[model samples]
Target: MNAIVTMDALTVDTGVRDLRAADHLLHTLAAELALPEDAFGCTHLVRGDRPRVALSLAFPSEPLLRTAQERLTARGYEVTPGVPDPMGRAVLYPGVSSLTGTLTIAELLSRSAIARVTVLGSPGQPAPDTELVTRDHVRPHWHDGELVLTAMPAVGGTLVPFEVPDPTPCCADH
Candidate 1:
């Protein structure tokens, strides 16, 4: 799906070289900055010879953005004024805690900033009562200024997010 972004963003590059570290830093920064309720924190994979995970954040207000930039900069991070890409998997967002464990489609929407939930190749949305086993990792993307999650059907007629917490490489043991 195409992304339609009309939001202000900031990026941080502290040479974070892995997803785990990036996730930890994102949480630390969010707490240290006391980010406002509407903030979104995401990790973008920068793959190449020198692979790394880059952090991006979208703030609802200018003052909040500036404060984040200032505080992050003070901590020796390379804080820039824009994001690497529009589609970032959210790590910190409203009601993120409620997304853990099993939840109904209706419960997910009611508890979080997510505006829509879609299932892959289903031809239609899932029933509200359909359960989503979050796997303790629910990464929703920003679409048209609204948060959207895409899940896939799993065993037992339940669902799981498309992006998992731990992913295997194509030829890991080759």
Candidate 2:
């Protein structure tokens, strides 16, 4: 079989009486998915009178998400990818969380969701004060904590926070 992905399953009974159990389940799932410790959750009505809680885990990619989903599915748990907000995509990690979102560095920084950000310099070589900026291809993990880009000698550029603009927009947005 392919490498196993994701972690484990958690369960909670239906109704408000099981809210705490549900909350703890979500929390545990988030942690297992490697979601940041600050991720939050809430309860929502899914069908007439019956309600289920939604847990939000913020992550960086699709493979990570597939892994999480597979794990839950293996344990007989149903998982669904939540709709993305105006941002256009939701977070996906090694495990599916309650709710998720894709965000830019500025947005993440502005929201104060992440504590710090770093730029990886170049694709294979080190350049003092410069970083790689890839414009054509993007990886699922590219948006994680420290964003790295592929650098071209002609561009003489560096990877800036996703929020910043390139002096020369020659590199296309990946």
Candidate 3:
């Protein structure tokens, strides 16, 4: 089961400048869901006639996804039909409500300050919690007004990790 959610007609200030605030809101949503911080991918900019922020969030289980959807809808944002990604894996679109803090993935990871490492994958199977131990190597950079996280490849496969941004800048433009 995959889900895709999109919130349209959200008006921001003229000089809001970037989607960093939006990304931070997504991060907060993930935390609210109790999902691991690394499960979300970096937010990217969708350039075209009208630009928008494109972000990818992952959940290790199904129940978590449902809860997130329900929470998002309750907040009065329009959610798109949930769908799957290119990997046939479920995908859910989280509406940007408001950001409570302003911190980057790097800062969040630092807060976690991983003390160990673990790998949960075998050949032909995607590794689970692959970056738990070496999460410090991951770096987040802002690209096109979105946060881009680059993770270190472990065993030649990519693993999604989570982080908690510190001193998260609040979305005051609301």
Q: How many backbone clashes does candidate 2 have?
A: 13
Per-candidate TM-score against the hidden true structure = 0.84, 0.34, 0.38
Q: By TM-score, rank the candidates, best first.
A: 1, 3, 2
Q: Give the residue spans of candidate 3 off by over 4 A.
A: 1-17, 81-174
lDDT of 3 by residue, 27-53 (tens): 565567675533443344546665665
**lDDT winner among the candidates?**
1
User: Residue by residue across 1-174, what tens digits does model 2's lDDT show?
Assistant: 101111221221234333345545655666676654333222232444655543333334556556766666675665555521211111222222221243343433344323234444433533343433324222222233322222234243434333222233445675
Ranking by lDDT: 1, 3, 2
Model 1 Cα lDDT, one tens digit per residue, 48-85 = 88788899988877788888888889989888887887
The local distance difference test score of model 1 is 0.84
Candidate 3 lDDT score relative to the true structure: 0.37
CA lDDT for candidate 2: 0.36
